[model samples]
Target: MSRTNIDIDDELVTMAMRLYNLRTKREAVNYALRQLVGDPMTLEEALAMKGVGWEGDLDAIKGGGPIEDLDDIDLDLLPQDLGDLDARDDR
Candidate 1:
C-alpha cells in the first residue's frame, strides 16, 4: 500500500480497466503488475477451480482431435488471406 506518483498513459489505464473489469486505475495497475510478475495460485485455490465445470463440446473446442502431425491439418479450413483488416466493416 505505498502511494507513488508516476507518469502513465490515461488511455492505456482506461483500456486495462475495461479489459479487466476493474473499477479504479489502482486496481488495473495492480492487476497488470500481478500479470507481469506471474501471479501463482495457491494449492487451495487450484483445488477450488476443480469444482468449476465446463458444459461445452470438448471435441469441437479441441478442433476435432489431437493433432499429432502437421500433415493432418486441413488447409482449406484455415483462414486464407485476411488482407487489410482496417477495410473490414464488421469492426
Candidate 2:
C-alpha cells in the first residue's frame, strides 16, 4: 500500500482522540468513513427494529404507554418559559 500524509489542526485532533478513544489519526478517519456508508433513506421492516427511529404515532402516546384521551382533560399544567438561560456563549 502507498503511504500519504495529511495535515489537521492540533485542537481538532485532540478532540477526536478523546471522543473516539483513538490514539491515532488513521483510526479516527477510518471510523468516520465507515459511518458515512449508512443509508438514512432506506426502507426497513417494522419488526426488524427494537428501538429504531420513528415518527409521531397515529394511535399511540408520544413518550410510550397507551393513548391519552384529550376529551375532557385540562392542558394548562405544562411549562411555557425558558426561565434561567442567561445567554449563549460563542467560544
Candidate 3:
C-alpha cells in the first residue's frame, strides 16, 4: 500500500464507517472505494443467469409481443373502508 494525502469529507467518512462497520477512517475509505468500483460482469453471464427461479412468462417480453395494459383495472372490487387504521382519537 502506498501512502498518499487526500482531502475527504468528515461526515461522509463517518457515515461510511457506520454503514460498513469499519473502525478506522482508512478501512471505511477502502470499503467505500470498493463499493463504488463494483465487480464487472459480461452480458453472456448476465443473460445465462436470468430465469433461474423466475416464474414470469419470458415470451411476453420476447419477439415484441403484446404487453398487458393496467389502465383497465376494476377499482370497484377494492375495499371501500379501512377499519380502525388509527385507534388514537387525538384531533
After superposition, candidate 3 runs with Cα above 4 Å error: 40-91
Give the Cα error of residue 1 in candidate 2, in Å: 4.7
In candidate 3, position 5 carries an lDDT of 94
- Model 1 stretches with alpha carbons more than 4 Å out: 41-91
- Model 3: lDDT equals 0.65
- lDDT per residue (tens digit) for residues 1-91 in model 1: 8999988889979987886568999998987788668998657546756856555554544587688888876666555566767856743
Give the distance in Å from residue 56's predicted Cα in candidate 2 to where it truly belongs. 14
**Please, what are the lDDT tens digits per residue for candidate 3 over residues 1-91?**
9988999889879987775467999998876666568955557646756666555444443435443666544445444464666744632
User: Which candidate achieves the best lDDT against the true structure?
Assistant: 1
Candidate number achieving the greatest TM-score relative to the actual structure: 1
Model 2: residue 2 alpha-carbon error in angstroms: 3.5
Alpha-carbon shift of residue 78 in model 3 (angstroms) = 21
Measured on C-alpha atoms, candidate 1 has an lDDT of 0.74
Candidate 1 shows a clash count of: 0
Backbone collision count in every prediction? Answer: 0, 0, 0
Ranking by lDDT: 1, 3, 2
Q: Quote the positional error of residue 41 for candidate 1 in Å.
A: 6.5
Can you give the TM-score per candidate against the true fold? 0.45, 0.36, 0.42
lDDT of 2: 0.55
